[model samples]
Target: MSQAPGLGIPGILHTLREYLVFYSGLGLLAGVSLLWSVLALPLRLVLPRRWRKQTGRWVITMGFRMYLRALSIMGACHFDLKALDTLRGESPMIIAPNHPSLLDALMVISRSPNLACIMKSELVDNVFFGAGARLAGYIRNDSLRSMICLAVEDLRRGSHLLLFPEGTRSNRLPIGTVRGSIALIAKEARVPIQTVFIETESAFLTKGWPFFRKPSMPIHYRIRLGQRFDPPTDVRGFTVELERYFQSALAEARLPPLSSMGARAP
Candidate 1:
């Protein structure tokens, strides 16, 4: 007997399997993450200052990587990265990437081991990322001076610090303005800035979206690391230069500028 004209049983079964795996993984991750956070709280409060924070961050980061791997195994998404060698075991460096999606932060951390980030003040209160963020000693984005100081100190202590120069997610379709804060931190710490750009086609986990929808098509990410440049002594000049560099990179990637989408400069 001939098969039906539409999707075959095998195809349908495959699709359903993929979906089940994706959602199930997400659910499992949520449950385990909650338990981990709760357990870490008391340890965070009772353990010695240094060890407590370090242990807590490691737990969160390792958990995050496992979650990402689960998603990859489900074939929900994939990433293409260039210049991976540059990031291997590099520390005392300010690694900056364009912020286009909420997942960008996780992507960066997953790629770089022993990495800390400059996160927003609101993240400090967020249940999902807050506890771990505090334990990791992520620099709060609210205070420029304080954040810079913290970043410099992290670098001094041999920790890699990742930053999003745009400060927030891009409102535009493409690249966003490069805030001067990153440049300032680089200069103050006397470190070179390692630039990275990420391009993703998945709209499921976007800038402000809360719901998860499986994409009709597979999502792909293109991540490239640009050459490191010495921080410019001329702060304003460096900002303009970095902004143009980001714009050009996005353009080359065939993506739109964040400014075109009404994204404000940070």
Candidate 2:
């Protein structure tokens, strides 16, 4: 009999490994979220307001850390996130980064335990994720003034604000236009912006990507710490400069394509 292209022992084993890693990644994410939901309910009732938010943030961080660890152990992904550890000793500030994939937030959160993320209103109201996010005191991005006030409060409470300056993922390469929310929050809170650059080669979870789609194995992701911008006095000017900075910084990064339209702004 003739030899088949992908029917050999090693090829079959490779295919099996990919499937195992892919599904396990999905399952682990849901597994952690569901587990957190169950645990958050009673904790909310028992703990005080401050304690609840603190505990919620800690547990979410640990859960994400473990999930990423599982993926690493399974040879499914490589995470170079050590750059974020240097910020542990720093004071509360906005942790700004480019949103490349859905995993962008996951990567940052897994490393920084005290980050208060800005979530979309709908996601904050999601049944599966709402409980934990609500309990964690994550800021919602529906109302501008409310979002800014809550973000400043979180910073005042000594939690790093996790803000994606792009506001959403870049549909094309390099980056999308940076929004003013980051600068405004920093100015109002009097906190600096700790810029982070997340570089990845996979398109697994970019905007509009399929939920259950399987990607290639051993996806490599690297995060680099960028310039720290002072609390801006000029929101509009800072927003313009911020976009230019991202355009210059990520000019060489291998960002995944978020859409097939080929570089149209959202």
Candidate 3:
């Protein structure tokens, strides 16, 4: 008797299908990002100094939006945003958010306009985005002292910057720990830090997990902007006060509190 046509097709066909889908998704993401990055380069020279700043911000925002779109398209992940209305058009403010997923930066940038980010040195050196980041003038993560100074100057010039108080992505469920750097920056800049929290259900997109597998679903995010805390005359005193403010805010937000994290006074 002749062997059934379907007898051995399942194994080989399944493997080939998975590989094709995976590589095709990768190629599509890379191609689109390259085009977006190339198109954004000219704005650097065409725009005026003041306009240059805004244009640079737009590039970063667009890059992030593209990244999110690619994720949604390839991984079948849906994006759900909440409480963005509170942050729209707000500037010269220090944005503090709880870091839970790798995509937190993308989400924040995608929603905000003309916002500067405090990024790690490694990302600045990344082949994919280093060129764009340099052109955009993102504050380097190294040299905390210098970064603090730059942040203060940016705020004075009516520019907004984002800071992850945790200083890194959290590994725990609720949140890991918040660094004192944010509190110090708020104090020195004499501005308020807008607190936010993000929550997601997909393990693939969770902190430190970037690989896409098994079509993902829409993930939920919760963003909270707490009442602003004015800077105190004494910078050291202000740091303590601000840290306490964040701790309380986190607690109220139903996330992990930072009181036990031992935030240092400036």
Among all candidates shown, the one with the greatest TM-score: 2
Per-residue C-alpha lDDT of model 1 across residues 241-262, encoded as one tens digit per residue: 9888887777756342332334
Candidate 1 collision pairs:
172-261, 174-256, 174-258, 175-257, 175-258
Comparing 2 and 3 on lDDT, the stronger one: 2
When sorted by TM-score, best at the front, the candidate numbers are 2, 1, 3
C-alpha RMSD of each candidate structure in angstroms:
4.5, 3.4, 7.8
lDDT of 2 by residue, 1-266 (tens): 12223778988888887888799889888877987887887888889886888888888888889889999899888999999999985798999999888888889988888889999999888766788998898889999899999999889878899999988877766788788889999999999998899998888778777778777778889999999999999999999998889889988887876656434764
TM-score of each: 0.83, 0.93, 0.72
What residue pairs clash in candidate 2, if any at all?
none
Q: In model 3, which regions exceed 4 Å deviation?
A: 1-29, 36-48, 66-75, 208-216, 232-266
> Which residues of candidate 2, in runs, are more than 4 Å off?
1-9, 261-266
Residue 5 CA error for candidate 3 (Å)? Answer: 26
Give each model's whole-structure lDDT: 0.72, 0.86, 0.64
RMSD of 1: 4.5
